[model samples]
Target: MTSPFDPTPLPPPECPAHASGGAPEPEVSEIGPGGLRRLYGPAHEKDPMGLYEKLRAEHGPVAPVLLNGDVPAWLVLGHSENLHMTRTPSLYSRDSRRWRMLQDGSLDMTNPLAPIFAYQPVCVFADGAEHERQRGAVTDSIARIDHRGVRRFINRFSNRLVNDFCESGQADLVSQFAEHLPMMVMCQIIGMPEEYDEELVQAAREMLKGSEKAIAANEHVMGALYRLVARRRAEPEEDFATWLVEHPAQFTDDEAAHHLRLVLIAAYETTANLIANVLRMVLTDPRFRAQLSGGHMTLPEAVEQTLWDEPPFTTILGRWAAGDSELGGQKIKAGDALIVGIAPANVDPVVRPEPSASMQGNRAHLAFSGGPHECPGQDIGRAIADTGVDALLMRLPDIQLSVEEDELRWRSTLMSRHLIELPVSFAPRPPQEITGPVIPERAGAAARDWQISSPRRPDPAASGTVPQPGPVPAAPRTAPPAATVPAQRRGSAPVRAWRTLVTWWRGY
Candidate 1:
């Protein structure tokens, strides 16, 4: 028997002679535990849609599968079935504590995949009245954000990131651009100093990878949030942290911090992946680019299409059977784990008859999930991705993939699929000069209270220079010297290849 984590691709299943002779095939139950397909492994990672189709043919919509430890779970595949499972919270609970494997110690807490499924005291794990309280706090606090101001931040940060690479003529969009833009914008929204953006991004990525470092990385993230919550308590600011702290639910300091961490990580991971996916599509698909350039399709439409086709998260872990119940014709016992197959359901033939056809203008994808636990901050993620992608394209209209599409690679975990690197080449250009205030004036006094810090200008009096009243002349545009560009910004093929290998080996 092959190991679940085996990198070797499995051969396609052959039709039995009995099937050609009109004999009935074996039932899924008779296949036994050992015969169940593993959700991990290189074959699934390379082509998950193929795996989903095979499972659908063999075991119907809710297929029995093994997780990392050969731990049994059900993967819900049908679009409607996924909706049914998520919508009926009474029948299927989000509380991981209710999972039977955890109860029986069959699922080791130290398992690499455990970090993702481990129960925490945040809104994501709560159900019923407790869920309402926590979810309300999160939603209400997010509602207080000025979205127009968010777009401004997205544009400013997007340009700043592009400026870093626009002078190099070659860049890896994944590491250099897509990865950092979301967190930088998020820092402004959460009232954290922009300088801490890199640390937060690193911590969030490490925590989600479910590697050995996940636990320590999670603690590091929580520690940052705890400090932020403490600061907000004394000095209330117009930010998500402050609003969450002031919610009527009156979360304890720890509870507030956990919720803040939840928002930060969720927004960061989804948006970062979304931006990368959209950029990859634009760079690789001539049809997509033509449509956008010709005004036949808009960037938001392209974003929506990517959400349907290549959602950031592939499989989410997961809802548990609240009691003995039936789902997609499967007998789900109390405490049985059921993972939501987000990517599979999106291409489900029942809803998407032509899977290869365009998904433009469709908003029914399970990318952000559905029902009571649906992502409350999905709109914010969309805004960041859409605005950020548009800004990059506007700045580098000639950008194209530096390698063949087939040469591109991805790193897949049970929970998400990530583009490892997206190398692209374009003509080097001068950086755009930003001339306005960082925060829009319409943001009001609350916005002014927590201004994004910037470098202090030298005082004329201290410099012993008298100011001239005439307007300063605009600087002449010139290509930045190659020596001035950062080594990583140059996007050296050998360096990028080594980095990609390290990232893949790390399971990120």
Candidate 2:
């Protein structure tokens, strides 16, 4: 089932560029079903930045569209032409094999947009010096991490998931705290085994909702990451799947389980849709809840204004071209594909013309995307979304929202916009005194050795409240002890044959 669109031909003697002769076949159309209901309707899932400002005022800075309705491609939408096509990888090339409609097979390799533009072997589907040796073993194992031990392992999995719904004062917070605290701190930084955290967050959330059981949920998360790289090569710990099976880019154990399934599916799909779109802009925007409840916004300025006005990956995948150029003014050819429009280049009125009057001293945002395959663990997905939005604004400091920010809903998909649930409400407090030891959730290997020694979690570099520049240390206290869970697991033999292969692969 390899077709996440594989093409591969632009290497060796660098040959394939042949389409010039009479330079024509470009402007596509077929987008029917009433133009795919005006580009994925429900008003483009509740105003996709007003449909990227009406497709950048009628297709200006590179637009073209279609996908699923016909398949076309090219998107970009300015911001210095998506930073010169993602910092010029020699005229664009994050290898979607080297597309030309999946190299002339004319697309549709079981298209449901084949689990995000197909071809996966990780290091974001390599290119040039094999994308710097699988992105230098993921930026040198995320630069030998420590961001205050990732803000105390995301404040002990955001206070053990807000003490499992903080005594029912109401919650949903996107499936109990922004989709299971970044996939349980990416299965405790890939050492996995907390009895397979809800089967790897339900097989990476139905293989990122491109479902139809997305290729058997991407082979049940690549057979639980090739059995956690064969139990960290027969038991070697200190996580990140034993630092990518003891990396130095010697890979191969299925290339360190495809770069640990590309850093655990890009840390559970773009850090849980960027901490559920900065908690839906701090509970429905009223100017970021009066500048995040008055201390003038900081949780890294509401995650850099939610990565510059709403951006949990607004498309940045396919980028093929590499030959007959022109871009922004159109003509692209050689292989074609493109994309990048990251929410229309972060509101690009010729490069952010007063996008919300320059979001509090802006921090240029392609949302951790740009250049030689950007996002080397975007500062550990912004320290697990600024320590799970500073552990729900320091333990639900009077939370809010139980509905009506125009009654939410969004989640159409063709590259995430997320929020199929947030629901809120607060004023509960009290439950925060657990010092540590609580195991017993079918105590398998004593609950994966108490999530590998109670959040003594480390790996993910840091620095003073996010202006960023590394060298860490000093930040520890991760909460975990209040228990009560039972979805079964008990004893071992590789977690009872990996919980009978995730209950016989979810009985289907």
Candidate 3:
């Protein structure tokens, strides 16, 4: 049995073009220095859309680009072209084994991009009947989820996360809220213990960054998934993991584990970034905020607009040419790799002539990609973002960005672009009392007594300033004493701290 992580190259799977003859060499002009552009670098990281515009101007919709390690591939930049590539799976394949570089052994498991493109047993890397089997299991399992229960979990986790910083009057929304909310909710849905979330979050994020640690991070995530699958198999539960294990597809332990890994990382990364992006737009753009708060634009509409303008995933490592074809006036050969330029395609001039115009109610954006391989968990991602953002805003209506818009930083990679921090300030508030089980019983097992750390009380003596009359000062007001939790329920250090803060809040 070969290890999935085996560094040894395997023989390229045979394709129609390979049987007819060898794939044609790309035209010299197209492969030349002037024709090819590298897709990862400071230039691209700083201004990917600007760089996409230049590439579109020079190379039309299907531009030749080099990924990390100077590996060559094509980037599909036109909206129509992107749809054509993804929709016509007969002409393009999702299987990375068909990739020319992978076939020739020029690309290997060690490449930073390998974490994305390396072949896995999961549906994302399958095609034909195999794809249908794996994808059906995922879709069926996802469809079984109770969305209302999902929203409850989202609300509960959102409140808990906000409580960690509400009393401080200042917090980094990225670190404190956006990053943790999605995974925490997902843990409940997937039947994983909440204690594993912090480690999973760190590993999932590191895996997507295409860094030297990406492979290791990916293994860590998979190892955890394997353990979860084993537990579920031994004693099944009514959660996503158990569903996959018992699906009619009869997935092996390895297959079930890989698919769980797929759903977890994909959902966590996309939703986390979506939450961050939506919040950033609300804080930075007064007009956008007015529309939402004024009831002119719904939160879902704002999320849609963000998807079009700044998708969570800027690019997805992507379809391989099934045979010779032409797209966006560029000739493609069998086995040529083509990345889906999601963000660029959403703004393609052909479909969206005025990129600045609103994208309300338009679900055509490729933010979630399209075709048979489109994201199965997109609705879940949207639900998490919408419910989480709405909860935060409702709890902290006075929230405002603590730093200037220009000062906010972003981390970009081949697959994603996300905020590094979203520092914000708001009137200090007390923690919401958890009156009932945060996790509804129907949402799997009864809620665990997970404890969260108490937020720091602002130091009034350190400020030493005269109070302003127009608005409340940054210093937190004295909170009331919190009720004590039963000793048996005081689970973790964080929760112990939270109880102390809650007790203090009750005295205010």
Worst 10 residues of 2 by lDDT: 484-493
Off by over 4 Å in 3: 1-35, 439-508
Comparison by TM-score, 2 against 3, better one: 3
Model 3 lDDT-worst window of ten: 1-10
Instruction: Estimate the TM-score of every prediction.
Output: 0.81, 0.33, 0.80
Model 3: how far residue 430 lies from native, Å: 1.5
Residue 17 deviation, candidate 2, in Å?
42
Tell me the tens digit of each residue's lDDT in model 3 across 64-172. 8877655678899999999998999989999989987677775666565676887888899888999998998899778767664456557667888888889999999
143-177 in candidate 2: lDDT tens per residue? 65554444555666687788888888888888888
**Best-first order by TM-score:** 1, 3, 2
> What is candidate 3's CA lDDT for residue 477?
31
Summed over model 1, clashes come to 0
lDDT of 1 at 240: 75
